[model samples]
Target: MTRVLITGATGQVGRELVEVFADLEVTALDRAHLDVTHRDDVLDVVRRLRPHVVVNAAAWTDVDGCESDPERAHRVNAESVRWLTEATREVGGHLCHISTDYVFDGTARRPYREDDATNPRSVYGRSKLAGELELDPSATLVRTSWVFGRYGSNVVGTVLRLLDAGAPLRFVDDQVGCPTEAYDLALTIRGLVDARHAGPVHVTNDEPMSWFGFVQRVAAAAGGDPEQVEPIQTADLVPPRPAPRPPYSVLDGSLLHSLDTTAPGDLDRAIERVVAAMRSTVKR
Candidate 1:
């Protein structure tokens, strides 16, 4: 069995990755077991276990929190990857790192390819890009966007909650990007790992839509009123967000053509599956 170690096992993607790689000799660790930010601990764990692969899903994903504390952001997102790279080197293991679309400034007219120049606009984006820089060319970097799943926090649950509560729904129509289900993303990752794919590759639905569009789809999939979602602009946000978001951060799987990988499953069907799964566990 191929030895695989997964970090941040409690996260949405991390959880799905655990399930997807279940057939392997998998060891999943949550933040409690392994804090990637601590260099010595990271080195010790990788050296001790000596897994063939280290899938790093651990990241300080608090975008607003990152803006407030750039130091912690750099440590968790950027510096952590640096340490992981070193540790993986010692073990001679393949490092498969999850990345985000925020690496780009989101201004391009076309979809973002793997080789496009990056101009991260926020602390989170900058830190993530820094993490990407820490990797060797042979390491696998998977970039995705607008991810939702059955676990943890996501827009799918948020939309369902508001719909269930009969609250007014409003979302921005200005920001456009692709939505990726965590389950499908894991499948894509599994393929990449098996192929020993190197360099950056985007994993997302081919088409892009506005945030308002995504919310409507989620509502429809959850048996709620899709039309109930009120479309608004970024400027219409009452308090405004702390971090700068890309207006058009849709990632195109152009590199997928060259690689032995496929994009995630259909967007609508994936949303329906997640919505159904989430509904089953709803508080009675």
Candidate 2:
């Protein structure tokens, strides 16, 4: 039996990974159990467990927060990843790290390929890119975008809450990317682990859409009035966010598709599943 150690076990991706890889000798660790930012702690845990794989799902995901505290972000995203990779390599274990689509500058007219030039516009992106570069050949770097799921706070959850509160929502139409479901992403990760596929792979839902279009779909799926969801440019909405967002960061899923490892759900079906799951949680 393969022993797998998962970091950020309480997170959306980590939770889904735990559920998907239940058959494996899985030791799920949150920050309480293992702090990746602490090199000694990470090294100690890996040496103690001696697992076959280390899947790192823990990340400082607050994009705006990263802009304000780049140093902390680097510690959490880049330095921690390097530590984990080195630890895993020392133990002859594979490291599976999750990354974001923000690595791209979003200037591409079409979807971003895996080998495309990475020009990160924000601190979060740069940190994630650095993390990716630190991984060894045994590691798998999975890049996704607009991720949401049932485990924790996400864009879908936030939108639903706003709609339930009868608040007018204005989403930026200028920004575009694939809205990925964490469940699908988790399954894809499991597939890659099982197959021992290495290198950077882009994993996301099949379709891409603007934030306004995505919000509209979410509202419609959640039984909200779509007309109430307004469209605006990124410049129109001024939130006190610290980072600048990519105008377009849609990732090309062709690479994963060629390997027959692409996600099953598209944007429409993904939204439906998310809405159903959220509604079930509310009823409970």
Candidate 3:
């Protein structure tokens, strides 16, 4: 059986990845079991098991928190990649790294291609881009945006919760990007691993829409009133966020097309699946 080791196994994407790779000899390590930030521990464990592939889902994903603690962000997000890459290389294993569309400044009117020049605006984005730079040339780099899933707290959940509580929802309408489902991204990662596809690949839903639009869709998907989501400019947010977001972080799946690998289907359908799953879990 193929041996696969998943770091951050309890994360949004990691949880789904663990389920999808059930047929494989997979070692799923949550942060409590394996701290990727600890270089010696990572090397020790990776050298011992020497799995055929290392899927790194570990990251410091709190954008605003990263702004307040850039050093911690570097340690968790960027330095971990370096350690994992070194260890994976020692074992002659393939490394599949997760990245974000935040690497770009989001100033462009057109979608960002795989090879596009990156200009990250926030500390979180800069740190993630640093991790991208640390990857082995042959390693797979998957960049996605606006990810939501059942395993973690995400925008979808926040929207649903706020709506359920009758709280006024104000979302930025200026920033636009793809709302990628974690389950779909995990499936794409599995396919890429099987094919041994290397280099950076942009994976996201086909459509690009505003954050306001996304919340509206989430409201609709969860049987809430979409009109309750008030569309506002980024500047209008009270007690403004610490980290700056890109106005346009839409990723182009042209590489997927060029490689003949179809990106996941529409965002609406993905939202429906996620909402349904969330409801099912709640009912149980």
Best candidate, TM-score: 1
lDDT (Cα atoms) of all candidates against the true structure: 0.93, 0.90, 0.92
Off by over 4 Å in 1: none
Instruction: List model 1 lDDT by residue over 1-284, tens digit each.
Output: 89999999999999999999999999999999999999999999999999999999999998878999999999999999999999998889999999999999999999999999999999999999999999988899999998899999999889888998999999999999999999999999999988889989999976699999999988988888888899999998989999989999999887875676756878999999999999998954
Per-residue lDDT tens digits of candidate 3, residues 148-263? Answer: 98879999888877877899999999999999999989988998888888999999986899999999999998988888889999999889999999999999988886775546
Candidate ordering by lDDT (highest first) = 1, 3, 2
Number of the candidate with higher TM-score, 1 or 3: 1
1-284: candidate 2 lDDT, tens digit per residue? 99999999999899999998899999999999999999999999999999999999999999988998999999999999989998999999989999999999989998999899999999999999999999987688899999889879998888999998998898989899988899999999998887777999999986889989989999999999888889998888776356878889999988898885545467678789988998899989
Which TM-score value belongs to model 1? 0.98
Query: In candidate 2, which residue ranges exceed 4 Å CA deviation?
Result: none
Candidate 3, residue 266: Cα displacement in angstroms equals 2.3
Task: Judge candidate 3 against the unseen true structure and give its global Cα lDDT, from 0 to 1.
Answer: 0.92
Worst 10 residues of 2 by lDDT: 260-269
